[model samples]
Target: MKKTTFAFYRKTMLTMISLGLLLNCSALTFAEENSNTDENQQVQEEILVEQTEVLTEEVAVELQKEETVEQSNKSIQTPKVHFSIYFVAEANGEVTGQTKFDSLVSSDLFSNIVTAIPTPVANEGYEFSGWYWGNSYIGSTSSEVYSYFKRGAALSDLTITAKFKQVETPKVHFSIYFVAETNGELTGQTKFDSLVSSDLFSNIVTAIPTPVANEGYEFSGWYWGNSYIGSTSSEVYSYFKRGAALSDLTITAKFKQATPKFNVTVKFVTEGKGSLTGNVTFDSTTSDLFKDVVATMPTPVAEEGNTFDGWYLNGSLIGTTSQEVYTTLENTKLLESTEIVAKFVENTQAQDPITPPTDTPTTPPTAENPQPEQPVINEPVEPVVNNPGQAQQITPVAPEVQDETILDDATPEVINANNLDTIEEEVTPLALGHDSWSLINLVLTLGIAALAIMMVIGKKTTNDETRKVNKNAKVIGCITAVISIIIFILTQDMSNPMALVDKWTIVMLILGLVQVVTSFINYKVKENNEVESVNC
Candidate 1:
């Protein structure tokens, strides 16, 4: 054989072998694909069989429900609401009524009420409080027609109880008389009547006694006879209850003599055509008596050749001296809100000049109560000319006299709402003179309650919009809590930690802390839930 022929045959055999190997691989792949297809078909058949079984079960359930409905339709009758009326507190009554879902709708509520029952009669010395349907007070109605069932309640077996309570008897009258300087002297300014009527064991409500302010004597604590009532603080509020034994309520405000000093207001009131050297209003101070208070009378500048006369006190001639200072303090009857007048006579001396006399007394400016500027406050007009072109000038009374504010820092404001008595007549100590504090407390309480309600509403919300709003609620709650805490801090004195332990402060603090903690916890829980959902 030839070499070329042999080579060609070998190459052909090699090609055939390669082709057969390729075909075997293709066949094995095809067989595997067929096996996979069979398995897939089997799985599909099983899934179809499960789906058919589910459908069949659902159909059966629906058929059963339908059959039940049909059977119920055959036996269905008119729906009647059941209600049982029972007497409470030894009362007797018979009540009967029928109510339906028509009463539940808002449009048909009033028209659908079946009020045909009679009210219960209570025993002697007892008054019916009200009827309780599902443990709710619906108010007491003593008419012949009474509602056996509540108007908008669902059709369920309800028990209505007619509650009765003992009749309240009138309280024995008593007097809450005050003793300051003397008995019943300042009580006339108060609306607290002598014939006071209250409950048998009600609390004793005393108006904040602040009107009796003495010049040198400080107001001490109130006393019942010799016994001292608690809390001598200037802003102390009463929370004491009245005793069961009725008697005259006498609260005495004893004043210790803090100082022997006194302030006297000396007004040079114009009686007979003369002008003072300065403003008519003046202030002078003295210890113990009027003689000690040497109030220098302003030199009188008489017009039309008139002469200055001697000063007179209560129509009696005081003295002709420039500085009239009495030796003994007891001789000077000077006290709070005292005024003095110096008269000017017409030509006491014929040779007197038009100007003020040389012997006329002149008041020197003191360091404490310095003479104010000549022009009055809010002055729209020119400076007052008492008499045309006179050396002594007097400030004319303003169209509206600007009241001067005299501050006694030693004495606290004891006048409460009872002084004006214009505020709400609430019985609580907090409302006595602290209406603003009370209002702040009320607002904080309502805000806390609202935040709690919002939290509960957002607790289980799942909608995207609703969840977003819920997330924002935490921020709002946090802000609200912070505000409450700030208010608590600002309102309290915080000197003694115990001083800040009032009812409002405690309640607000607790509520604020709880709000912050719960809001943080809620936010964290929601974040964790979101993370878990993302991971899933």
Candidate 2:
């Protein structure tokens, strides 16, 4: 039983091992197939990705080409236009030829031409052919055209008939350039247009007309108001009339007037076109001719006293009672008037005194000589004077005289005169008053008061220490007191106030007051210091 069990176990083990190998092989094959399939799938996916990348690259290149084509189309679409026109004489008429123009179609020629063409009319048996030869089409849209036609035999003269149609009142500006040919023929060629001449037009037109004007019209001259017109063969004519009537012309009169007490001469000259007429009237109130003469003429005055008393005209002295006659040249009847005044000076000396005449005896003494011998009997006899004393006693007797005659003749009179000595003594005191004394007193009083106040205020402050206070106070007090004494001496009037007694009295009083105040303060401070020491 044991051996049989062993064989079955071995077979079972071998069968199990064989089954494991088969399973391993089947898994290996399945894994290999799956890996190969995955590798193929990866390769296929890589190819699809590369194809997508190539397609994307092709799409980008196409987009770039499309942009290039669009840009090229834009470049070709808006081309710059450049053109020029030239006038050429054809067989029968003048035609404008297009020398060069930008790329344009045939239909664009009509609008690009500068000139207009008129429709032909059939007259008689002649027919009008429209256009001869020329390609005038221009622009990209081909909406413009230009045509040229030759004149037929029916037309005798070639006339350029141009009718301007202002579709929008187009401001047509043109510029002409003249090209001189070698044969001395001048031709106008268009160079540019829309030229602005406002900056230099006035200066240019002020001189001569441009050469582009008609050759027949002559530009003559220009003035303030109007321009002159002239022809090639006739004289120039002015626009201003020669003699024109002026209305409401105002004439202003100006003349020189004399100033106060002075004469003036005026000379007139006209500036405007006119003649002045009128007499110049002058009044004595407004004119200074007579006033100036009177101011210059000297008046007469008394020689003895300061008084003006008379006047003289031309060396003729006028009396005080004479009428007020003015000096004038009116009666002289001269062409130019002149006045000559003579100044009169009166003699003011006192008049001479009159003398009285004394009476004398008119009768002659010779006829009365006979009566002299017959002396009067009543005449007293001559006294005999041989024996002196005794003869005098025997003299003839004389008649008695009246006492009343002596009394009425004369009386005694007494006269007294004042002495000059007392008068001079009295006038001396009145000449000098008390003006000096009042002035001196006022000055001295004010000066003394100011000095005393300065001394009190200039004292040292109370807050200073003892040594510093004493030193400063002494120095300041001495200086102030010395200055005050000096001021007192300078301002005092020594002559009037009893000399030293009155002048020094106020100064001594001020010094005494200062000393008293200083001494009292020093004593009080000393007592306070002593008390503080005892209490400590």
Candidate 3:
């Protein structure tokens, strides 16, 4: 009985070793068969690992060769085994349903089987950390292959909870404000305040607001603290950034006012009989300070005997012009309340005529019986006076007209019987021995001599007209010589012959010499021309 028991134990040990080998060989065969499929290959690799561990240290001692062969044949003949893989979601990620895995397995197959791995889903504001198997972390892979070999043969269900790290996106807010200068308003005024993401943290793309129309105001630019942000424009936008950890940002849009103007008044006045022309009503602003305004002065329409003088400003003479006066309105004095005047004066050349008294009778009175009614006339008169002793009623006679030019320098003289006849002979001489006879004789001599000289100079050859003119010149020359000599002789007084000879006598003598010289020259030229004509 002892020998039989020892032999039985040895056989049992041998069978267990053979079965363990068969199980290992069967696991390898399954791994080779499904190696082409990714899921199947993964499952087979897991099962091979578990089976190797068991076969290495525990499988031979547990089962005999016959039993191991029976389990291997049973696993190969049986259909696929069903198992559940549960995926739990976290951090707003997508939840996964239970996944089913089917595979042929043996008693050792459960130790080597691989579990189904679910695909990881994404979530905003959260980063995927890693996958979890119950309370333990599996891997960071999205679709990692899981093995349940360590769970043993009774393991059929798996619970994997998805893990995630909470994303910390700090919130930021920016405030925008519209600011204006004193008494200035803005148009399209607006403000902004909202939450922004760390990735989406940027400036606001908005144009700066403008001032209202006709407000005389202008928009400058947006400002952040003391620095300039941007200019004002309809198409422009502003940018806001967080520079500090706890930022308190506020921007301002600035505006400015317009410039002021001044008032100016000008007046135009006439000092003479003239008037102001061209926009006399001068009231304007200093906006056109660079330009000069002109005011034309009207021509002075003086009275009958008056003349225009010149233009004056504040009693001082500016300039003189007979046509029109022009004054510059740009003068600083004219910018304020001021006036300009035109002056005139009487013409000295325009004088009134002097007339004799009309009340005096033209008739002269006798010394013995002068009419009491006749006024005694101290001034000179032209009618004749009768010296009859009896008082005779005489008809009033018209006074003789006298030459004003001649009387301008001559004094009146009374004529008596003794000098009456001599005065009449001197005044109305029929011959050329009168008071103006010298001037007439000189004028005639000069005129005739000039004509003769012109004819001689102009003549190419001697003609009948030429000869006639020369003969007339000779006759006038001889008459002028004789008259001059006679006048010279008459001007000298025998009683006072040494007295200063009158200047007129010397002039007459000089004229006589000139006439004689001119006549001789004319005669010589005429003779030469006549000879030339004859020779031709």
Pick the lDDT winner: 3
What's the C-alpha lDDT at position 229 in model 3?
70
lDDT of 1 at 411: 29
Runs in model 2 deviating more than 4 A are 1-283, 287-464, 498-520, 533-536
| Preferred candidate (lDDT higher): 1 or 3 | 3
lDDT of 1 by residue, 253-340 (tens): 6766554446666566556667668655655553635544444446666667666675666677666545552432237555465545
| Candidate 3 lDDT tens digits, 274-352 | 5545555455565423123333434446666767677777787766762323433243334344555667787866222
Please give the lDDT score at residue 314 for candidate 3: 73
Instruction: Give candidate 2's TM-score.
Output: 0.18
Backbone-clash count (model 3): 3
Per-residue lDDT of candidate 2, residues 294-378 (tens digit): 3223333233433443443345543332234333422322112233332333445543321112221122223222122223323
Which 10-residue window of candidate 2 scores lowest in summed lDDT?
245-254
Flag clash pairs in model 1. Answer: 290-332, 291-332
Candidate order by TM-score, decreasing, is 3, 1, 2
